[model samples]
Target: MDLNLRKAIKSNVSGNSADQLEATIVDAIQSGEEKMLPGLGVLFELYWQNASEADKDEVLNALEQAVK
Candidate 1:
């Protein structure tokens, strides 16, 4: 994926507002396929763009764990 898409995915996963993130994540989860993950990337980008350093670190840590 592109850097922007990666950043976006990271952001949505760590956003402060639960409601928007919840709906977006639910949609992605319900889709249940790699094909749908990109749509979620849009929201991810939005959240990631505004994320704090601490939040970014948390997300990166979780991602590292998931990768294992």
Candidate 2:
């Protein structure tokens, strides 16, 4: 069977409230599981899709700073 992981992750978290979403991100980060990375990437994709250009730039800047 072919499974689409991004779709699955997005669907799972689609209706989450801000607090619940924050909890999901925090849990994923703190748990440090490799499996959680895909879900985090999905969440980041969602945020990127909805973010303003300035917000996107800000996030990119922070990420660049973090990686340096």
Candidate 3:
């Protein structure tokens, strides 16, 4: 995890519109830098915390497919 969580914090993402959030996510992935991982982890943690069990299972299934 080499992400700069502070930069995202500065962007005040809690108020982000859908497009802004999407752009942030896209930029992080496209950068392909190892340091962006912590930011992604934070995003994933947020999702995991809020997701239902079915959603978690679905995500795990897809992840399983990709990692194979």
Candidate 4:
């Protein structure tokens, strides 16, 4: 993936709900395995489409701590 594009996606995640972020992360990992991480945005959008606000918050919080 292009470094600039990755940076752009990272920026899209600021203040994003946890469910949304998790879906993105999952997509990234899945795509990365296929050498298709550049397509992670689609996963993020998919998750966002179905996730509840609470689900998003929970995933986001878990992600913040996990990354630390």
Best by lDDT: 2
In candidate 3, the residue pairs with backbone N, CA or C atoms under 3 Å apart (3 or more residues apart, or in different chains) clash, namely: 2-35, 3-35
**Tens-digit lDDT track of model 1 for 1-68:** 44776566666466456887687689779879997768666766666889999999998999899999
Clashing pairs in 1: 8-44, 8-45, 11-48, 12-44
Instruction: Look at candidate 2 and tell me the lDDT of residue 65.
Output: 100
lDDT of 4: 0.72
**Quality of model 2 by C-alpha lDDT:** 0.94
Q: After superposition, how far is residue 32 of candidate 4 from its true place, in Å?
A: 4.0
Cα misplacement distance, residue 48 of candidate 3 (Å): 0.4
TM-scores of the candidates are: 0.60, 0.92, 0.78, 0.43
- Residues 8-58, candidate 3, lDDT per residue (tens digit)? 664566877889878989999999998877777777887899999999999
Model 3: residues >4 Å from true position, as ranges? 1-11
Worst 10 residues of 1 by lDDT: 7-16
Ranking by TM-score: 2, 3, 1, 4
The runs of at least 3 residues in candidate 2 whose Cα sits more than 4 Å from the true structure, single-residue gaps closed, are none
Q: Considering summed lDDT, which 10 consecutive residues are worst modelled in model 4?
A: 34-43
Better of 3 and 4 by lDDT: 3
Candidate 2, residues 1-68, lDDT tens digits: the string is: 99999989988988889999999999999999999999999999889999999999999999999999
